[model samples]
Target: MKHPYTKLLANIIAYAASIILYALNAGGSINGLTILSITLATIASINLVRAITTITERKQQ
Candidate 1:
C-alpha cells in the first residue's frame, strides 16, 4: 500500500531540517519556531519510518 502523502511528508521533513540548520548557522536564540521545527522533523521522520515498515509488511504478505 503506497501512501499518497509521501511527497508531502518528505517536503515537511526537508523544510523542518532546513529551518533547524538555518537557525543553528545563524547563531540565533532557541525560540518557539526552532523548537516547533525540531518537533515537526521528528514527527515526520517517525511517520516516514512507519510508512516504510507498512509497505515492507505488505510486500512480505
Candidate 2:
C-alpha cells in the first residue's frame, strides 16, 4: 500500500518531466529528444496505470 503510493508519486514526477520535455521538443524540429520524451511519457503513463490498478486491487482485497 505504501509502496503503491510511492510508485504513484514517482510516476507523477516522471510523467511531468516527460511532458515538459515533450513541450520543449514540440517547439523545435523533429529530433531524438522529441522521440525520447514521447517514449518516456508513454512508458510512465502505462506504469501509472499499472500502479493505480495495483492500488485498487489491494484495496479490494
Candidate 3:
C-alpha cells in the first residue's frame, strides 16, 4: 500500500522485532552492540514516522 499507515506499521513492527531481539540476546544486562542496534532501530522508526507524517500533510494540502 502507498498509504502512510503502511510505512508506520512496518516501522513499528521492525522496531518491535529489534527490541525483542535485544531483550532475548541480553537478558539481564545489555551489551554495547545490542544498545547500538536498539538505538539505530529507534531512530529508524522515528524517521519513518516523520516521513509518514510529511506524506499525509502533503496529501492534505
Tens-digit lDDT track of model 3 for 22-53: 67776867777777877787778778778878
Supply candidate 1's per-residue lDDT for 47. 81
The global C-alpha lDDT for each of the candidates, from Candidate 1 onward, is: 0.77, 0.72, 0.77
Question: In candidate 1, what are the lDDT values of residues 1-61, reduced to their tens digit?
Answer: 5666678677767877787888888866778877886887788778877887688679879
lDDT of 2 at 49: 75
Model 2 gets an lDDT of 0.72
Tens-place lDDT per residue, model 2, 1-61, is 2654666677677777767666777676546777687777777777777778888789889
lDDT of 1 at 5: 60
**What are the TM-scores, per candidate, against the unseen true structure?**
0.57, 0.53, 0.62
In Å, residue 54's CA in model 1 sits off its true spot by 0.8
lDDT of 3 at 48: 77
Backbone clash pairs in model 2 (N, Cα, C under 3 Å; residues 3+ apart or in different chains), count: 0
Clash counts per candidate, in order, are: 0, 0, 0
